[model samples]
Target: MGEFELIRRYFAPMAKATKPALDGSGLLLGVGDDCAIQRVPANQDLVFSVDTLVEGVHFPLGYCPRFLGWRALAVAVSDLAAMGAQPVCFTLALTLPAADEAWLEGFAAGLAEAGQQFGIVLAGGDTTRGPLTLSLQVHGTVPQGQALRRDGAREGDLVCVSGQLGDAGAALEFLYDTAPATDAASLLQRYHCPQPRLELGIALRSMASAAIDISDGLHADLLHILRASGVGATIDLAALPLSPALRRIKGGAAAGFALQSGDDYELCVTVPEQRWAAASRELQQQLTVIGQVQQEPGLRLNADAGMVYSQRPGFDHFSIT
Candidate 1:
């Protein structure tokens, strides 16, 4: 099948299905265009971010196409979530080894489901012949002055993360059979179907002092906020959130994963003490306070006697072997 034909068969319908429902909203033009046009509402600033995922590096050798479709878009939109942006639309660039019809069908179905979930539409994209890789550029918008930024953290701000951590890390073990358990559905879901903290990020608008989505491991991504704001933090080890599945199935690695596992897609935010109560009420117990921002310039973990300095690198795509 030809490229345009492939798009028509699988992707064009996604755009067409949602076009009329929009009734001339944020996305003006979608699909079959050299460029997609969108309208930004007054007092809102446009936000854009692109993410690329290659087979093997980003996923297993033969991950489910449908889940891959959802995950690819979820990870990209997580950037918008981090910035307190409401997802608008996205463009995709897919490279495949072949025009596998079955793969395309499942992948498109998954993509469509995620699009609906995130309230985003597919604008336009390209398909090329090569090693399988999915690149998506997501567009969003945030209120002019309320966009969350990483450089606004202040001393005494509380560091918080949404949802329990370590589930994804435990799930990774099962993917390769490195861990002994085999009946971990929730952990596997954590790995395959990461839920981006979109609502929480949007709610964080003026409440959070600074924020970032935890794409890398919790420690690694939180370090980004600290560095950007020129601040430091002290995280209590006991306060790290661990899901029941992770604690029960992969107990030994629970702490490690919570501290260093990647792909959680949860939000790590810093909010001032005065705002903590308001933020707490807003989240409605969906978040946990794990640490506190400080004037010092390093990350510390609480220990029995004192704080332990840590500089461990998170998942690095280009780590030296």
Candidate 2:
């Protein structure tokens, strides 16, 4: 099939099927155009971010296209979630080795599924022949001056994280293994599909002083916030939220996975000392306070102030290979 024809046959339908905005908002025009039109509300600020996934580097060759489609967009949209933005629409740029109808159909299905779940419509995109890669740009909006940022952390603020960590990192070990480990399904699910904590992000707009999605594990991602905010932190090693599945799979090294492994996709937030109680009451147990921002210049564990962290801090695409 030709390029335009392929788009019409697979992708165009996605925009048409997307859940329309309630009260007629956001995307003014989508797909089937030279440029997709968006109408950002006057009172809200526009937020957008791009993420790209190369086949071999990001996922295994011949990975499930359906899972890849969902993960790629979810990963990108996590940026909007971190900013506490309301998702609007997304544009996908897909490069494939060949126009495989089966793969395209599966991918489109998964992308459509994620789009509907996130309340994001398909704007427009490009498809081309290449060594399979997927790039997504997601757009969102937030109330003026209400968008969450990573540079607002204050000394004595409680550092919190949404949901459990380390499951996805533990799952990485079983990705290609024919023999599945204990509780592999639970761990693998975390890796293959991560739900962006959009609702939690919105909730944090008022409650959190600083926020970031935990894409690069708690250690690395939280450091970004500290560096941005000119602060330091003291994390309680016992407080890291390692899932039971991760504990079962990783044995004694579960804490390392929780701290050093990547792709958790949870939100790391800093709540002020005074409002931590209110934030706790609102978010309940799903949000865990594992640390506290301090005036010191570096991160340290509560147990050991001067000990080394890990052999490798976290996932660094360039540094790993």
Task: Using lDDT, give the best candidate's number.
Answer: 2
Write candidate 1's Cα lDDT for 1-321 as tens digits: 999999989998788654433444588888987888888877789999999999988888988899999999999999999999999899999999999999999999999999999989898999999999999999998989889999999999999999988777668767755444544777888888888889888888878989888888889999999999999999987788888877776555456557887888999999888887765565748779999999999888874443233457877778956
Candidate 1: what lDDT? Answer: 0.86
- Residues 69-156, model 2: lDDT tens digits: 8899899999999999999999999999999999999899889889889988889999988999899999999999999999999999
C-alpha root-mean-square deviation, candidate 2: 2.2
Any runs in candidate 2 off by more than 4 Å, and if so which? 18-24, 177-182, 280-282, 303-311
TM-scores of all models? Answer: 0.93, 0.94
Clashes of 1: 0
- Candidate 1's TM-score: 0.93
Give me the overall lDDT of model 2.
0.86
